[model samples]
Target: MSSSPFPDTDLAGNDARVGDGRNLDSILRIPVLMQVVLGSATMPVADLMKLGRGAVVPLDHRVGEPVDVMVNGRVIARGEIVIVEEDNSRFGVSLTEVVGPSAADQNT
Candidate 1:
């Protein structure tokens, strides 16, 4: 296993993992939010029992508007729906509009 020069110090202490420390830059080259779009939600069991094949569980979004993209329960961005192919589709949220906890996000 790779070891940290500052092994005694934990990540929270410095947010640094050992290596060339320079080689660590490669981690940044990796995609930032890959596969983060998958989602599933659970409501009350009573509600689940009410659902049927044809029933529409209204999503918290409106037509022609960007839907709130969440990850692990935090609202991250807004995006409109897109159909890439006949059998596959996905959302394309603008990175520029990704939401953060405050009025301003560092990404913006």
Candidate 2:
């Protein structure tokens, strides 16, 4: 039998084999930037320059449409905006679907 060049031991120096609980535990702790995309708009230079306070620019998406969730600038999921609680004090995104790598590639 041959041994893998990459040992299965984790940073804690435990057995921590691959595909086991510990391997994923450490990885899950890594912080990542998450962005919720509302929508976008395109306008000419003249129109863009005319914008001021209280200006309302229309976007392509509707109010109830699902928004794209991006991680590291790549679209990784889709979700809808939701309130964290019934109080409506905080906002959050409720995941609708998780995007696979192939699907994410097309979006980017």
Write down the TM-score for model 2. 0.67
Deviation in angstroms for 82 in model 2? 0.9
Error in Å for residue 66 of model 1: 1.2
TM-score of 1: 0.45
True-structure lDDT of candidate 2: 0.88
TM-score of each: 0.45, 0.67
What lDDT score belongs to each candidate, Candidate 1 first?
0.58, 0.88
Tell me the deviation in Å of residue 15 in model 2: 11
| Superposition error at 15 for model 1 (Å) | 14
Which residue pairs clash in candidate 1? Answer: none
